[model samples]
Target: MSPDTRIHRARVLALSLGGLMALAVAVYMTLGAVGSWSFVLSYRGEKLLTILLVAWAVPVSTVLFHVISRNQILTPSIMGFDALFMLIQTLAVFLIGAATVTQWPPVLVFLGELTAMVAFSTLLFRWLFGRIAQSLELLLLVGIIFGVLFRSVAGLLQRLIDPGEFLVLQDRLFASFSGADPQVLAMSAALVAAASLWAIWRLPAIDAMILGRDGALAVGVPHRRMTAEVFLIVTLLVAAATALVGPITFFGLLVANLAYRLLPGAPLRLTLPLAGLLGALLLVGAQVVLERVLGFTGTVGMVIEFLGGLLFILLLIERAR
Candidate 1:
């Protein structure tokens, strides 16, 4: 197909995805409203906001991560952020006791998690990107190693903690849309917005970086600096979302690859926005189905993980082939 035709088709697909996302939001907010409008609005509004924030954060982080790593299958969670988040939560409970951790202010807990994630990612990425000669293979290997290390430590800590505390930590380890705190919601929105703005400003650099490191360098892009900047932005986005709703292993891969297929050959500007919309659509739509059709028998995260795992395996198979 011609370039113009491809762009036109991409635009149409993006608009269609946006429209469906809007429909999903409407259904989520107004489908089963028997209570007072104000009450329903206030209640569902908080959940919707959390969903939207996560929707934006996850796909953006995933896409930027893919660009930097040049691997469509890799995501922020794969870099050990999710494991690190769990470890931090487990440590908090282990050190302070479950009762104290639960009694602590949500804002304080959120801030502590966010700060720890940012600090950890900053140190990790600096070492990976700055000192390692910018090898993608090295970065991936180190990330996987750190992920295993974090999970092992968390497992040991969980084993040593009281059973009740372990249960509390286990509850917090999985993602949940229903338990999203309003305080964390506000903080996450601000962080996601900041990261979005930075990504927007660097769209040109990102486009160049998509050409790979050597090509970007040949075309005057400062590959090292741009890669670091992308990593920082990805860290903040992933950290905020993970803190808000816990770790989601395959949701990023699902929405990001869907965006790529839906908008084939599209640039980052189009693909990024479309990916965010698709993320929201998939998340909110899944929530709607779980609530309305499945009676909320399971958490949305569980369903997403199941589907995402299948997709991950399929992609691996395809890559091998």
Candidate 2:
């Protein structure tokens, strides 16, 4: 068979296998008898939603960022997103003591963070992309610089805060799937659905966008306006996921690259669904193995982050060689 045919067959096989594995994991998570199955399922469902939300949001946003930037190495979170998110969290806890912060409803905090992140992206994009000659590389560098600035400010605030507040800030920074809140899940799902609908409506335009800036613009595509819309969509996604489950920094890199390697010839339509499916499978399976099989009570975020980091290094090496 030809190379493309072989690749297509392999991706079809992978998708089938991944889907079955995900189903098995879901069953495993729900099959426990030691605890009240009802209680276990409720908590597990919360975590499942968290994993699924992040699974959907991160890879999609990362893919969009890669397409717009024309660089596989860049993602929305690469642009100081994690730092900005942490800064917001730190500022909140610092300003309102740990006890009070913890007492505040998670839903309110989530909405607030969502508003802040969207506003931040809107302002940044408006100012940066307003100039016709600005390069993505330049924009990326500025993002990194701004991220450093946010981190520095957050660090200073942490140092000045009460010791108890610092402890709360530190605790808040860890990524934890087990602590998923249902209210956050509802909000995240709504936003992701909206973004997905928007993506569907603009499918043809995104296909053209992959042709790079000048090429798309040459073909009469409103490249700048489309990119700005994409950036806003991606920012909303990243913000919701981060605010809900904390930062799964490298998860997008892992899943997106795996999708590229596993998809039926890297077409966005097939690749998007397959990537999302694989991502959900990976997280659900990981959670089951960690919690049920191994009897470990640790968070899923740590495991994904570790594996994702390793995959990232492998990608860098492969690219280098």
Q: State in Å the error of residue 173, model 1.
A: 1.0
Q: What TM-score should be assigned to candidate 1?
A: 0.96
Give the whole-model CA lDDT for all candidates, comma-separated. 0.89, 0.79
Candidate 1 weakest ten by summed lDDT: 128-137
In candidate 2, position 100 carries an lDDT of 86
lDDT by residue (62-162, candidate 1, tens digit) is 99999988889999888899999989998999999999988988888889889998998888777876786557678778888999999999999999999
Best-fitting candidate, scored by lDDT: 1
Leading candidate by TM-score = 1
Residue-wise lDDT of candidate 2 within 43-141, one digit each (tens)? Answer: 777777778888888988888788788877666777888888889988888887788888888899888878888888777776776674456666777
What value does the lDDT take at residue 36 in candidate 1? 97
TM-score of every candidate: 0.96, 0.90
In lDDT terms, how accurate is model 2? 0.79
